[model samples]
Target: MTTQRPETERQAPVRVFWAPGCSSCLRTKEFLKKRGIAFVSVNVKDDTGAREQLLALGARSVPIVARGERFVYAQSNADIVGFLGLEETAAEMLPPAVLVERLDRVLHAAARYLKQVPEAELDVVFNDFFAPRALAQHAFRVAEAFVEATETGEDYTYERMMRGTHDVGPGDDILGYGASVIAALDAWWQHCPDRSCSAPLRAYWGVQSRHELLERAAWHSAQHTRQLQSIVEHFGGLPDGPLGERELAGLPLPDSVWMEASADA
Candidate 1:
Protein backbone atom coordinates (compact mmCIF):
# COMPACT_ATOMS: atom_id res chain seq x y z
CA MET A 1 0.00 0.00 0.00
CA THR A 2 1.23 3.48 -0.82
CA THR A 3 1.52 5.95 2.00
CA GLN A 4 -0.72 8.96 1.70
CA ARG A 5 1.14 12.22 1.23
CA PRO A 6 0.11 15.56 2.67
CA GLU A 7 -2.14 17.63 0.46
CA THR A 8 0.62 20.21 0.14
CA GLU A 9 2.96 17.50 -1.23
CA ARG A 10 1.32 17.71 -4.64
CA GLN A 11 3.85 20.39 -5.63
CA ALA A 12 6.85 18.43 -4.33
CA PRO A 13 9.67 17.54 -6.71
CA VAL A 14 10.35 13.89 -7.47
CA ARG A 15 13.25 12.23 -5.69
CA VAL A 16 15.19 9.45 -7.44
CA PHE A 17 17.23 7.22 -5.16
CA TRP A 18 20.01 5.43 -6.98
CA ALA A 19 23.55 4.08 -6.86
CA PRO A 20 26.39 3.94 -9.34
CA GLY A 21 26.68 0.97 -11.74
CA CYS A 22 22.98 0.18 -11.36
CA SER A 23 21.49 -0.34 -14.83
CA SER A 24 17.90 0.06 -13.69
CA CYS A 25 18.83 3.23 -11.84
CA LEU A 26 20.29 4.64 -15.02
CA ARG A 27 17.15 3.74 -16.93
CA THR A 28 14.86 5.35 -14.35
CA LYS A 29 16.92 8.51 -14.23
CA GLU A 30 16.99 8.66 -17.99
CA PHE A 31 13.29 8.07 -18.22
CA LEU A 32 12.62 11.13 -16.09
CA LYS A 33 15.26 13.25 -17.85
CA LYS A 34 13.99 12.42 -21.31
CA ARG A 35 10.63 13.88 -20.38
CA GLY A 36 12.18 17.02 -18.84
CA ILE A 37 10.77 15.93 -15.51
CA ALA A 38 12.46 17.85 -12.71
CA PHE A 39 13.72 15.42 -10.08
CA VAL A 40 16.15 15.36 -7.20
CA SER A 41 18.66 12.66 -8.13
CA VAL A 42 19.84 11.16 -4.85
CA ASN A 43 22.83 8.84 -4.87
CA VAL A 44 22.03 6.40 -2.11
CA LYS A 45 25.61 5.21 -1.87
CA ASP A 46 26.75 8.71 -1.06
CA ASP A 47 23.82 9.91 0.97
CA THR A 48 24.03 8.88 4.61
CA GLY A 49 20.38 9.58 5.32
CA ALA A 50 18.93 7.93 2.22
CA ARG A 51 18.32 4.49 3.71
CA GLU A 52 16.26 5.94 6.55
CA GLN A 53 14.26 8.02 4.09
CA LEU A 54 13.68 4.98 1.90
CA LEU A 55 12.72 2.78 4.85
CA ALA A 56 10.15 5.33 5.88
CA LEU A 57 8.49 4.74 2.55
CA GLY A 58 8.63 0.92 3.01
CA ALA A 59 11.45 0.44 0.53
CA ARG A 60 15.04 -0.65 1.14
CA SER A 61 16.42 -0.45 -2.35
CA VAL A 62 17.95 1.88 -4.82
CA PRO A 63 16.16 3.11 -7.96
CA ILE A 64 13.10 4.30 -6.05
CA VAL A 65 11.09 7.33 -7.06
CA ALA A 66 9.54 9.07 -4.09
CA ARG A 67 7.29 12.03 -3.45
CA GLY A 68 7.40 12.58 0.31
CA GLU A 69 6.50 9.28 2.01
CA ARG A 70 4.92 7.86 -1.11
CA PHE A 71 7.16 5.93 -3.49
CA VAL A 72 7.29 3.36 -6.24
CA TYR A 73 10.05 0.91 -7.11
CA ALA A 74 11.51 2.31 -10.28
CA GLN A 75 12.14 -0.88 -12.23
CA SER A 76 9.05 -1.16 -14.46
CA ASN A 77 8.62 1.82 -16.74
CA ALA A 78 4.88 1.31 -16.78
CA ASP A 79 4.80 1.56 -12.99
CA ILE A 80 7.05 4.58 -13.05
CA VAL A 81 4.75 6.20 -15.62
CA GLY A 82 1.75 5.50 -13.45
CA PHE A 83 3.50 6.67 -10.30
CA LEU A 84 4.43 9.97 -11.90
CA GLY A 85 1.27 10.27 -13.97
CA LEU A 86 3.06 10.33 -17.32
CA GLU A 87 1.73 9.20 -20.69
CA GLU A 88 2.27 5.49 -21.35
CA THR A 89 4.44 4.44 -24.25
CA ALA A 90 5.35 0.82 -24.78
CA ALA A 91 8.83 0.22 -26.15
CA GLU A 92 9.37 -2.69 -28.53
CA MET A 93 11.64 -5.55 -27.49
CA LEU A 94 13.28 -8.36 -29.41
CA PRO A 95 11.78 -11.82 -29.62
CA PRO A 96 12.43 -13.93 -26.50
CA ALA A 97 14.68 -16.45 -28.36
CA VAL A 98 16.75 -13.67 -29.89
CA LEU A 99 17.15 -12.06 -26.48
CA VAL A 100 18.48 -15.34 -25.14
CA GLU A 101 21.00 -15.61 -27.95
CA ARG A 102 22.17 -12.04 -27.53
CA LEU A 103 22.42 -12.45 -23.75
CA ASP A 104 24.54 -15.57 -24.23
CA ARG A 105 26.90 -13.67 -26.48
CA VAL A 106 27.05 -10.86 -23.92
CA LEU A 107 27.95 -13.19 -21.03
CA HIS A 108 30.66 -14.80 -23.14
CA ALA A 109 32.10 -11.41 -23.93
CA ALA A 110 32.06 -10.50 -20.24
CA ALA A 111 34.07 -13.61 -19.37
CA ARG A 112 36.64 -12.75 -22.03
CA TYR A 113 36.95 -9.20 -20.77
CA LEU A 114 37.36 -10.34 -17.17
CA LYS A 115 40.31 -12.48 -18.23
CA GLN A 116 42.02 -9.39 -19.65
CA VAL A 117 41.61 -7.05 -16.64
CA PRO A 118 45.00 -6.39 -15.06
CA GLU A 119 45.52 -8.24 -11.79
CA ALA A 120 46.58 -5.04 -10.03
CA GLU A 121 43.42 -3.18 -11.03
CA LEU A 122 40.99 -5.94 -10.17
CA ASP A 123 40.49 -4.66 -6.63
CA VAL A 124 40.86 -0.98 -7.42
CA VAL A 125 37.44 0.65 -7.39
CA PHE A 126 36.18 3.29 -9.77
CA ASN A 127 32.75 4.92 -9.71
CA ASP A 128 32.45 3.24 -6.26
CA PHE A 129 31.25 0.01 -7.93
CA PHE A 130 33.35 -0.38 -11.06
CA ALA A 131 36.10 -2.59 -9.73
CA PRO A 132 36.83 -4.50 -12.95
CA ARG A 133 36.28 -7.89 -11.34
CA ALA A 134 32.96 -6.80 -9.82
CA LEU A 135 31.63 -5.30 -13.04
CA ALA A 136 32.72 -8.41 -14.96
CA GLN A 137 31.02 -10.66 -12.45
CA HIS A 138 27.86 -8.52 -12.52
CA ALA A 139 27.69 -8.62 -16.32
CA PHE A 140 27.34 -12.39 -16.28
CA ARG A 141 25.48 -12.84 -13.01
CA VAL A 142 22.67 -10.45 -13.95
CA ALA A 143 21.41 -13.00 -16.45
CA GLU A 144 22.51 -16.01 -14.41
CA ALA A 145 20.33 -14.78 -11.57
CA PHE A 146 17.36 -14.77 -13.95
CA VAL A 147 17.96 -18.38 -15.00
CA GLU A 148 18.48 -19.42 -11.40
CA ALA A 149 15.27 -17.70 -10.36
CA THR A 150 13.34 -19.41 -13.12
CA GLU A 151 14.57 -22.81 -12.01
CA THR A 152 14.16 -22.27 -8.28
CA GLY A 153 10.67 -20.76 -8.48
CA GLU A 154 11.69 -17.92 -6.20
CA ASP A 155 11.43 -14.17 -6.08
CA TYR A 156 14.37 -12.56 -7.86
CA THR A 157 15.39 -10.19 -5.11
CA TYR A 158 17.95 -7.44 -5.62
CA GLU A 159 19.77 -8.73 -2.54
CA ARG A 160 20.03 -12.14 -4.21
CA MET A 161 21.49 -10.64 -7.35
CA MET A 162 23.90 -8.40 -5.40
CA ARG A 163 25.25 -10.96 -2.97
CA GLY A 164 28.96 -11.41 -3.88
CA THR A 165 30.42 -8.04 -4.73
CA HIS A 166 32.77 -7.68 -1.75
CA ASP A 167 34.50 -11.03 -2.19
CA VAL A 168 34.97 -11.29 -5.96
CA GLY A 169 38.35 -12.93 -5.20
CA PRO A 170 41.04 -13.11 -7.90
CA GLY A 171 40.81 -12.53 -11.64
CA ASP A 172 40.82 -16.27 -12.34
CA ASP A 173 37.86 -16.74 -10.01
CA ILE A 174 35.96 -13.95 -11.74
CA LEU A 175 36.45 -15.68 -15.08
CA GLY A 176 35.48 -19.00 -13.55
CA TYR A 177 32.25 -17.53 -12.15
CA GLY A 178 31.52 -15.95 -15.50
CA ALA A 179 32.06 -19.30 -17.26
CA SER A 180 29.75 -21.06 -14.81
CA VAL A 181 27.06 -18.41 -15.28
CA ILE A 182 27.29 -18.70 -19.06
CA ALA A 183 27.03 -22.45 -18.82
CA ALA A 184 23.96 -22.15 -16.62
CA LEU A 185 22.46 -19.69 -19.08
CA ASP A 186 23.05 -22.15 -21.94
CA ALA A 187 21.62 -25.05 -19.99
CA TRP A 188 18.54 -23.09 -19.01
CA TRP A 189 17.91 -21.94 -22.58
CA GLN A 190 18.29 -25.43 -24.03
CA HIS A 191 16.05 -27.06 -21.45
CA CYS A 192 13.50 -24.31 -21.00
CA PRO A 193 10.34 -25.83 -22.62
CA ASP A 194 8.62 -22.48 -22.68
CA ARG A 195 10.52 -20.39 -25.20
CA SER A 196 7.77 -17.82 -25.16
CA CYS A 197 8.65 -17.09 -21.49
CA SER A 198 5.11 -15.93 -20.84
CA ALA A 199 4.99 -17.40 -17.36
CA PRO A 200 4.80 -14.87 -14.55
CA LEU A 201 7.67 -14.48 -12.07
CA ARG A 202 7.74 -12.46 -8.85
CA ALA A 203 10.59 -9.99 -8.43
CA TYR A 204 11.36 -7.63 -5.58
CA TRP A 205 10.60 -4.74 -7.88
CA GLY A 206 7.38 -6.07 -9.38
CA VAL A 207 5.68 -9.14 -10.88
CA GLN A 208 6.19 -9.52 -14.63
CA SER A 209 6.43 -12.25 -17.24
CA ARG A 210 9.67 -14.21 -17.58
CA HIS A 211 10.15 -12.66 -21.01
CA GLU A 212 10.15 -9.17 -19.50
CA LEU A 213 12.65 -10.22 -16.85
CA LEU A 214 14.84 -11.83 -19.50
CA GLU A 215 14.79 -8.65 -21.54
CA ARG A 216 15.82 -6.66 -18.46
CA ALA A 217 18.59 -9.15 -17.75
CA ALA A 218 19.89 -8.96 -21.32
CA TRP A 219 19.96 -5.18 -21.52
CA HIS A 220 21.43 -4.90 -18.03
CA SER A 221 24.26 -7.26 -18.89
CA ALA A 222 24.84 -5.48 -22.19
CA GLN A 223 25.29 -2.20 -20.36
CA HIS A 224 27.87 -3.72 -18.01
CA THR A 225 29.57 -5.45 -20.94
CA ARG A 226 30.11 -2.03 -22.44
CA GLN A 227 31.44 -0.86 -19.06
CA LEU A 228 33.81 -3.82 -18.87
CA GLN A 229 35.09 -2.92 -22.31
CA SER A 230 35.62 0.64 -21.11
CA ILE A 231 37.66 -0.68 -18.16
CA VAL A 232 39.92 -2.62 -20.57
CA GLU A 233 40.43 0.52 -22.63
CA HIS A 234 40.94 2.57 -19.45
CA PHE A 235 44.07 0.55 -18.79
CA GLY A 236 45.23 1.51 -22.31
CA GLY A 237 44.62 -1.85 -24.00
CA LEU A 238 42.19 -3.06 -26.63
CA PRO A 239 39.31 -5.34 -25.67
CA ASP A 240 39.39 -8.66 -27.44
CA GLY A 241 36.29 -8.88 -29.65
CA PRO A 242 34.33 -6.17 -27.89
CA LEU A 243 30.62 -6.12 -28.59
CA GLY A 244 29.61 -4.19 -31.70
CA GLU A 245 26.37 -2.84 -33.11
CA ARG A 246 25.60 -6.21 -34.67
CA GLU A 247 25.81 -7.96 -31.32
CA LEU A 248 23.98 -5.19 -29.44
CA ALA A 249 21.26 -4.52 -32.00
CA GLY A 250 17.64 -4.51 -30.79
CA LEU A 251 18.62 -4.43 -27.10
CA PRO A 252 17.45 -1.29 -25.28
CA LEU A 253 20.94 -0.05 -24.34
CA PRO A 254 21.65 3.46 -23.13
CA ASP A 255 23.45 5.82 -25.50
CA SER A 256 26.19 6.88 -23.03
CA VAL A 257 28.48 4.21 -21.61
CA TRP A 258 28.76 6.07 -18.29
CA MET A 259 25.53 7.98 -17.91
CA GLU A 260 25.61 10.71 -15.28
CA ALA A 261 27.55 8.77 -12.67
CA SER A 262 28.55 11.92 -10.87
CA ALA A 263 29.36 12.59 -7.24
CA ASP A 264 26.99 15.52 -7.57
CA ALA A 265 24.22 13.05 -8.39
Candidate 2:
Protein backbone atom coordinates (compact mmCIF):
# COMPACT_ATOMS: atom_id res chain seq x y z
CA MET A 1 0.00 0.00 0.00
CA THR A 2 1.17 3.56 -0.74
CA THR A 3 1.49 6.06 2.09
CA GLN A 4 0.36 9.67 1.80
CA ARG A 5 1.05 12.91 3.63
CA PRO A 6 -1.98 14.60 5.09
CA GLU A 7 -2.71 18.25 4.29
CA THR A 8 -2.05 20.95 6.86
CA GLU A 9 -3.43 24.40 7.37
CA ARG A 10 -1.78 27.07 5.24
CA GLN A 11 0.19 29.48 7.38
CA ALA A 12 1.20 31.88 4.62
CA PRO A 13 0.02 33.09 1.23
CA VAL A 14 2.93 31.31 -0.46
CA ARG A 15 5.53 28.66 0.33
CA VAL A 16 8.70 28.20 -1.72
CA PHE A 17 10.84 25.09 -1.66
CA TRP A 18 14.32 26.25 -2.53
CA ALA A 19 17.98 25.36 -2.17
CA PRO A 20 21.07 27.47 -1.68
CA GLY A 21 23.49 28.03 -4.60
CA CYS A 22 20.65 27.57 -7.06
CA SER A 23 20.34 30.67 -9.23
CA SER A 24 16.74 29.89 -10.16
CA CYS A 25 15.77 29.51 -6.53
CA LEU A 26 17.38 32.83 -5.68
CA ARG A 27 15.52 34.50 -8.49
CA THR A 28 12.27 33.04 -7.23
CA LYS A 29 12.86 34.45 -3.77
CA GLU A 30 13.82 37.84 -5.19
CA PHE A 31 10.67 37.90 -7.31
CA LEU A 32 8.46 37.36 -4.28
CA LYS A 33 10.48 39.82 -2.22
CA LYS A 34 10.23 42.49 -4.91
CA ARG A 35 6.43 42.31 -4.85
CA GLY A 36 6.23 42.19 -1.05
CA ILE A 37 4.58 38.82 -1.31
CA ALA A 38 5.05 37.14 2.02
CA PHE A 39 6.16 33.55 1.81
CA VAL A 40 7.73 30.80 3.87
CA SER A 41 11.01 29.68 2.33
CA VAL A 42 11.87 26.04 2.92
CA ASN A 43 15.47 25.13 2.19
CA VAL A 44 15.46 21.66 0.73
CA LYS A 45 19.21 21.18 1.06
CA ASP A 46 19.48 21.91 4.78
CA ASP A 47 16.34 20.52 6.32
CA THR A 48 15.30 16.93 6.00
CA GLY A 49 11.67 17.82 6.57
CA ALA A 50 11.74 20.38 3.76
CA ARG A 51 13.34 17.89 1.42
CA GLU A 52 10.65 15.39 2.23
CA GLN A 53 7.99 18.01 1.62
CA LEU A 54 9.35 18.76 -1.83
CA LEU A 55 9.47 15.10 -2.79
CA ALA A 56 6.02 14.47 -1.39
CA LEU A 57 4.67 17.12 -3.69
CA GLY A 58 6.18 15.10 -6.59
CA ALA A 59 8.49 17.99 -7.35
CA ARG A 60 12.12 17.19 -8.11
CA SER A 61 13.10 20.79 -8.77
CA VAL A 62 14.12 23.59 -6.47
CA PRO A 63 12.03 26.76 -6.34
CA ILE A 64 8.83 24.79 -6.26
CA VAL A 65 6.05 27.14 -5.23
CA ALA A 66 3.04 26.18 -3.21
CA ARG A 67 -0.15 28.13 -2.70
CA GLY A 68 -2.58 26.44 -0.36
CA GLU A 69 -2.55 22.70 -1.16
CA ARG A 70 -1.59 23.21 -4.81
CA PHE A 71 2.06 23.02 -5.89
CA VAL A 72 3.89 24.04 -9.05
CA TYR A 73 7.48 23.52 -10.11
CA ALA A 74 8.63 26.75 -11.73
CA GLN A 75 10.74 26.12 -14.80
CA SER A 76 11.57 29.75 -15.41
CA ASN A 77 10.78 33.26 -14.31
CA ALA A 78 7.95 33.38 -16.79
CA ASP A 79 6.21 30.56 -14.96
CA ILE A 80 6.33 32.39 -11.68
CA VAL A 81 5.40 35.67 -13.33
CA GLY A 82 2.35 34.08 -14.87
CA PHE A 83 1.39 32.30 -11.65
CA LEU A 84 1.57 35.59 -9.75
CA GLY A 85 -0.52 37.32 -12.41
CA LEU A 86 2.31 39.79 -12.92
CA GLU A 87 1.46 40.39 -16.55
CA GLU A 88 -0.72 43.40 -17.26
CA THR A 89 -3.81 42.49 -19.20
CA ALA A 90 -7.34 43.77 -19.36
CA ALA A 91 -6.47 46.77 -17.17
CA GLU A 92 -8.84 48.90 -19.19
CA MET A 93 -11.67 47.35 -17.21
CA LEU A 94 -10.44 48.69 -13.85
CA PRO A 95 -11.94 51.76 -12.22
CA PRO A 96 -10.39 55.15 -12.98
CA ALA A 97 -9.97 55.98 -9.31
CA VAL A 98 -7.95 52.87 -8.75
CA LEU A 99 -5.64 53.65 -11.66
CA VAL A 100 -5.11 57.22 -10.53
CA GLU A 101 -4.39 56.22 -6.96
CA ARG A 102 -1.80 53.62 -8.03
CA LEU A 103 -0.17 56.06 -10.40
CA ASP A 104 0.16 58.60 -7.60
CA ARG A 105 1.87 56.14 -5.31
CA VAL A 106 4.39 54.98 -7.92
CA LEU A 107 5.15 58.48 -9.22
CA HIS A 108 5.74 59.85 -5.75
CA ALA A 109 7.87 56.89 -4.79
CA ALA A 110 10.09 57.39 -7.85
CA ALA A 111 10.49 61.09 -7.12
CA ARG A 112 11.38 60.41 -3.52
CA TYR A 113 14.21 58.14 -4.64
CA LEU A 114 15.50 60.52 -7.33
CA LYS A 115 15.43 63.45 -4.93
CA GLN A 116 18.08 61.77 -2.83
CA VAL A 117 20.61 61.54 -5.65
CA PRO A 118 23.77 63.44 -4.60
CA GLU A 119 23.99 66.71 -6.55
CA ALA A 120 27.66 66.32 -7.47
CA GLU A 121 27.02 63.10 -9.35
CA LEU A 122 24.06 64.34 -11.38
CA ASP A 123 26.01 64.78 -14.60
CA VAL A 124 28.27 61.78 -14.22
CA VAL A 125 27.09 59.24 -16.74
CA PHE A 126 26.91 55.95 -14.92
CA ASN A 127 26.95 53.74 -18.03
CA ASP A 128 27.76 56.13 -20.83
CA PHE A 129 24.07 55.70 -21.52
CA PHE A 130 22.23 57.36 -18.63
CA ALA A 131 23.03 60.07 -16.12
CA PRO A 132 21.01 61.41 -13.25
CA ARG A 133 19.92 64.38 -15.36
CA ALA A 134 18.84 62.26 -18.31
CA LEU A 135 16.82 59.94 -16.07
CA ALA A 136 15.00 62.86 -14.49
CA GLN A 137 14.16 64.27 -17.90
CA HIS A 138 12.93 60.90 -19.11
CA ALA A 139 10.62 60.58 -16.16
CA PHE A 140 9.13 63.99 -16.90
CA ARG A 141 8.65 63.10 -20.57
CA VAL A 142 6.72 59.95 -19.67
CA ALA A 143 4.22 61.89 -17.61
CA GLU A 144 3.97 64.66 -20.19
CA ALA A 145 3.18 62.25 -23.00
CA PHE A 146 0.53 60.47 -20.98
CA VAL A 147 -1.44 63.66 -20.43
CA GLU A 148 -0.99 64.85 -24.00
CA ALA A 149 -2.25 61.62 -25.52
CA THR A 150 -5.18 61.19 -23.18
CA GLU A 151 -6.65 64.68 -23.25
CA THR A 152 -6.27 65.40 -26.96
CA GLY A 153 -6.95 61.94 -28.47
CA GLU A 154 -3.73 62.35 -30.42
CA ASP A 155 -1.20 59.63 -31.20
CA TYR A 156 1.80 60.23 -28.97
CA THR A 157 4.73 58.58 -30.70
CA TYR A 158 6.66 56.97 -27.91
CA GLU A 159 10.45 56.87 -28.25
CA ARG A 160 13.27 55.42 -26.20
CA MET A 161 13.77 58.07 -23.56
CA MET A 162 16.64 56.06 -22.15
CA ARG A 163 18.86 56.59 -25.18
CA GLY A 164 17.81 60.09 -26.19
CA THR A 165 19.86 63.27 -26.47
CA HIS A 166 18.03 65.38 -23.88
CA ASP A 167 19.12 68.73 -22.50
CA VAL A 168 20.73 68.53 -19.08
CA GLY A 169 18.97 70.13 -16.14
CA PRO A 170 19.81 70.84 -12.53
CA GLY A 171 19.83 67.66 -10.48
CA ASP A 172 16.95 69.22 -8.56
CA ASP A 173 14.70 69.29 -11.60
CA ILE A 174 13.49 65.82 -10.65
CA LEU A 175 11.54 67.46 -7.84
CA GLY A 176 9.57 69.90 -9.98
CA TYR A 177 9.13 67.37 -12.77
CA GLY A 178 7.71 64.85 -10.33
CA ALA A 179 5.29 67.43 -9.02
CA SER A 180 4.13 68.25 -12.54
CA VAL A 181 3.45 64.61 -13.24
CA ILE A 182 1.35 64.34 -10.13
CA ALA A 183 -0.58 67.48 -11.06
CA ALA A 184 -1.22 66.19 -14.56
CA LEU A 185 -2.37 62.85 -13.24
CA ASP A 186 -4.75 64.56 -10.82
CA ALA A 187 -6.29 66.66 -13.56
CA TRP A 188 -6.70 63.73 -15.88
CA TRP A 189 -8.27 61.64 -13.16
CA GLN A 190 -10.74 64.32 -12.22
CA HIS A 191 -11.83 65.09 -15.78
CA CYS A 192 -12.01 61.57 -17.05
CA PRO A 193 -15.70 61.43 -18.06
CA ASP A 194 -15.84 57.69 -17.69
CA ARG A 195 -13.60 54.62 -17.66
CA SER A 196 -14.63 53.95 -21.21
CA CYS A 197 -13.80 57.45 -22.45
CA SER A 198 -10.06 56.89 -22.68
CA ALA A 199 -10.28 53.35 -23.94
CA PRO A 200 -10.07 54.49 -27.54
CA LEU A 201 -6.74 56.29 -27.12
CA ARG A 202 -3.75 54.41 -28.54
CA ALA A 203 -0.12 55.25 -27.86
CA TYR A 204 2.40 55.05 -30.66
CA TRP A 205 3.69 51.83 -29.18
CA GLY A 206 0.35 50.19 -29.95
CA VAL A 207 -0.94 50.28 -26.38
CA GLN A 208 -4.72 50.41 -26.76
CA SER A 209 -6.01 51.92 -23.49
CA ARG A 210 -5.31 54.90 -21.26
CA HIS A 211 -5.30 52.71 -18.17
CA GLU A 212 -2.40 50.66 -19.53
CA LEU A 213 -0.50 53.87 -20.27
CA LEU A 214 -0.80 55.02 -16.68
CA GLU A 215 0.08 51.58 -15.43
CA ARG A 216 3.14 51.49 -17.66
CA ALA A 217 4.23 54.89 -16.41
CA ALA A 218 4.07 53.73 -12.81
CA TRP A 219 6.19 50.66 -13.49
CA HIS A 220 8.60 52.64 -15.63
CA SER A 221 9.24 55.14 -12.87
CA ALA A 222 9.81 52.46 -10.30
CA GLN A 223 12.30 50.73 -12.63
CA HIS A 224 14.35 53.88 -13.09
CA THR A 225 14.34 54.35 -9.34
CA ARG A 226 15.89 50.92 -9.07
CA GLN A 227 18.53 51.98 -11.56
CA LEU A 228 19.32 55.00 -9.40
CA GLN A 229 19.51 52.79 -6.37
CA SER A 230 22.14 50.64 -8.07
CA ILE A 231 24.16 53.72 -8.88
CA VAL A 232 23.98 54.93 -5.30
CA GLU A 233 24.96 51.50 -4.10
CA HIS A 234 28.02 51.56 -6.35
CA PHE A 235 29.09 54.95 -5.03
CA GLY A 236 29.20 53.79 -1.39
CA GLY A 237 26.13 51.70 -0.68
CA LEU A 238 22.73 53.31 -0.09
CA PRO A 239 22.32 55.41 3.03
CA ASP A 240 18.75 54.63 4.08
CA GLY A 241 16.10 55.85 1.61
CA PRO A 242 12.71 55.06 0.06
CA LEU A 243 14.22 52.32 -2.12
CA GLY A 244 15.22 50.48 0.99
CA GLU A 245 13.78 47.00 1.33
CA ARG A 246 11.34 47.83 4.14
CA GLU A 247 10.04 50.99 2.50
CA LEU A 248 9.51 49.27 -0.85
CA ALA A 249 7.51 46.52 0.83
CA GLY A 250 5.13 49.08 2.30
CA LEU A 251 4.38 51.10 -0.83
CA PRO A 252 0.62 51.31 -1.35
CA LEU A 253 -0.69 50.21 -4.72
CA PRO A 254 -3.19 47.89 -6.30
CA ASP A 255 -2.08 44.25 -6.27
CA SER A 256 -2.28 44.18 -10.05
CA VAL A 257 0.25 46.97 -10.40
CA TRP A 258 3.11 44.47 -10.38
CA MET A 259 1.64 42.78 -13.42
CA GLU A 260 1.74 46.01 -15.37
CA ALA A 261 4.82 45.77 -17.55
CA SER A 262 6.64 48.97 -18.54
CA ALA A 263 7.43 47.61 -21.99
CA ASP A 264 6.05 49.24 -25.11
CA ALA A 265 2.96 47.48 -26.45
By lDDT, the best candidate is: 1
- Tens-digit lDDT track of model 2 for 1-265: 0123234533436788876533345546766777777787787766669888877777666667776565655534444655555664322233545545655665666676565667788777765445766765665566667777788878756443332326665544657766886898788778778665457665542445676565555545555555666566667745345443332332222222211111111
What lDDT does candidate 1 reach at residue 8?
71
Tell me the spans in candidate 2 whose CA falls farther than 4 Å from its real position: 1-96, 159-165, 170-172, 196-198, 237-265
lDDT of 1 by residue, 11-55 (tens): 787899888777778878777778888898888777788777778
In candidate 1, stretches whose alpha carbon ends up further than 4 angstroms from where it belongs are 1-10, 259-265
Q: Candidate 1 has which clashing residue pairs, if any?
A: none
C-alpha TM-score for every candidate: 0.91, 0.51
lDDT of 2 at 197: 44
Q: Relative to the unseen true structure, what is the C-alpha lDDT of residue 231 in candidate 1, on a scale of 0 to 100?
A: 86
